[model samples]
Target chain A: MAGQSQQINISDLDVPQLADVRKQLEEELTHLTNSFSQLKQAQAKFRSCIDSVKEVAPQNQGKTILVPLTNSLYVPGKLSDLENVIVDIGTGYYVKKTRAEAVKHYEGKIDYIRTNLETLQETIQKKQDNMSVVASILQSKLQAQASDKANKD
Target chain B: MSLEARLQAASSEYARLQAELSAAVESRQRLDAQLSENELVKKEFAVLTPNNTVYKLIGPVLVRQDPADARATVDKRLEFIRSEIKRVEAQLTDYDARTEKKKDEVCLFCFPPLSRRAHPPLHRQLVQIQAQIQAQGQHTAAATAATA
Candidate 1:
């Protein structure tokens, strides 16, 4: 049957006719894009590729929770023990000033407080000295009175 | 219906919130500006306010009463009070000078001149002079009426 079909073709075709036939064959070989299954198949293939990536890569991770140690004194959002962090620092912000400038202001304040404390301490010391002197004087007076009494006896 | 519709709704909500935030920011800015203006005005008014020495002289300057027992309790409360009084007097003088210095700035606020305090020295002299003048005028008027 193959030999009979091959022998039936005559070699009488011209160049223009052969060219037209070749063009018609090419047009006929082109695929129709209106097929729904082709689109679905392409989509499935894309999804399979995504699934393969998911399997090879990582899975959906959950949120992380940070737990403090048992002896940890500080909680995440809790302030200081008896005061807030800012107030606990024992500093005040100056009016329309920077930290360094405010520190300079505090330097004067610290000096003033130190001076007052020293003066108070000194005055207290002086009072204590006066008290000791009076105590000695009173003790001597009592001794003198006792001696006088003994002499009279 | 779809993710795009949901996203569009979210975007619209976000935009509305953003607009509200912008309006709030503008209002805050306006309030801040108004507050600053008010402070400046107050400072200017205070500066322009005329200071009188009267307030200083109005108070008595009697000595603090001595403690009943200076030897007892070992406290320096009376001394501290006297010291505090002196410090306050000095501060009052300093503040009065400051007020006088700020008088020009206070003029922008446009207030009446502060009345003078009842200065003992000036008041005493005024009383004496007024009495003498009244007596002289009365004597002269009596003499004139007798002649007529």
Candidate 2:
């Protein structure tokens, strides 16, 4: 009968559920932190790329270098900071990236970064909101308990 | 004896204001459409090239221009975008200011924000005011659109 019947364990589920929420919020915080790491890496990549472009095409290099977006998504504030990190690999790399075969290779990495960023941002916002809600709930409950004690006294 | 004449004059003035509102709205719609088209063009340009790219796509872009001509075209387009943005912003500001003014003229008889006097037929007056508000909203939207 134990094998056939589904078990519905209800003991301390609500308290345990709160712990579960905390764990999820922590995970989300970690992911949000990852965005900073990616930004740093992107900055490094851009610096090296710009250096090489400056060597070959010094005059044109002084002007803005095209940072071709493989994935079309905008995360305004985060991406705006990313503007400083574009490294123009060189004319050869540019020509190769323009070539269909070479472009597809980088597309894989670009798509991953874009998707990761989107999820990370959303998780960060949601977790912060959840924490605020939980805090308010707790504050209200505490006030109610204190009021009950006062009434008895 | 000419009480009817006074009523006719008020109705005529009201009709004139309504017509002006509609014309303004139509003009705004046209402008809005133009702005939308321009925005689309800008997006397409950004995509075909790259963000923060120095050179924008010139339609059927003629290459190797005289330095002077190339510089002038670039300067002009940039100026155009700057001016267009400012113009739209100003129009929005004007609309906002006008709306705020209209709101301040709320019925003095009714307390709090929307005081429409406690007349016998409160419902009818409220309905008329509500309709006027909606029509004003449309008129504002149309005016802004015309500017676009």
Candidate 3:
């Protein structure tokens, strides 16, 4: 009978119930904070990649380069045609493109990610604000209850 | 909505947001890893000279490609990653907003931050419930007096 309904009145909750609610909110806050940091890290990495692509494009035409076999290893390589570009079209297929097309593609991608990052930042701020509000309300309510009990005693 | 319905809706919304956030974080990690790999490929392209052999995978076959072509493909991949990240992030943001609104709606009592004008229907519902409770209590008292 006690577990039949899930309705809860926050104002009517006793100390034990409030403590349970607080625990849940704290967990959610922790999860959101972790997600925010991870998103930030991803944004930073994306920005760095864009910058590197921009800087490395014009200067590398017809120059000797080493390709990475692994993170810490590389093999000797060179570009036979500066104008010809290979693009992977998924399913293990490759297509051809010009250097300009490649640059345009990455630039378009950068714009898309930038918009996404901005929206995500706003959401993160909202979550943070919500968490703080919840925490403060819970703190004051607990304190108020304690003082009420003291006055009566 | 009734309190029970409102509570259920809010809990569901919170759960959905949690799932969406988790998925977004997972996709971000995957995109970050792809970016790291492409960064290395871009580095390789920066130092490419004429006659350097670039191998590309075509249907499980490693075919030799021009260095320029390989770099273009790498750039395209990086851009694809960017698009994916954006899509996931947008979903995350949307879910976050919904979750925020649901949280506020459910905790209307704990956090009476909602203005009366903004929550007229809910305010009406609560007032109705309070009046009903008072009426029931008075009726019970009258019955007890009659029995005595």
For each prediction in turn, the share of the native Cα contacts (below 8 Å between chains A and B) that it retains comes to: 0.00, 0.00, 0.12
Q: Write the residue-wise lDDT of candidate 1 on B58-139 in tens digits.
A: 1333222112221121134334444554655565456434433433332322223222253455445444543443343333
Clashing pairs in 2: A46-A87, A49-A88, B27-B146, B28-B145, B28-B146, B29-B145, B29-B146, B31-B148, B32-B148, B110-B115
* Top-lDDT structure, candidate number: 3
Better of 1 and 3 by TM-score: 3
How would you order the candidates by DockQ, starting with the best? 3, 2, 1
Q: Give the per-residue lDDT digits (tens) of candidate 1, residues A25-125.
A: 23222211222234345445544534433332222223232336567653443211221011001111102222233333334344544564565455445
Tens digits of per-residue lDDT, candidate 3, A1-153, equal: 112356655556665655654555455556555655775676576566455445446567667788888999999887666665654433343445455555554555556557766775776576567457556667888899889999999
Q: Which scores greater on DockQ, model 1 or model 3?
A: 3
Error of 2 at A82 (Å): 33
TM-score of chain A of each: 0.36, 0.43, 0.65
- Cα RMSD to the true fold for all candidates: 54.5, 18.9, 16.7
Residue A107 lDDT, candidate 3, scale 0-100:
58
**Highest DockQ against the true fold, candidate:** 3
What tens digits encode model 2's per-residue C-alpha lDDT throughout B1-148? 3433433344344445545555545555555545554443333233333332322334544223233443454355556656665665566556556544544433321234333454435545545654565455544443333232
CA shift of A22, model 1, Å: 99
Ranking 1 against 3 by lDDT, winner: 3
* Best of the two (1, 2) by TM-score: 2
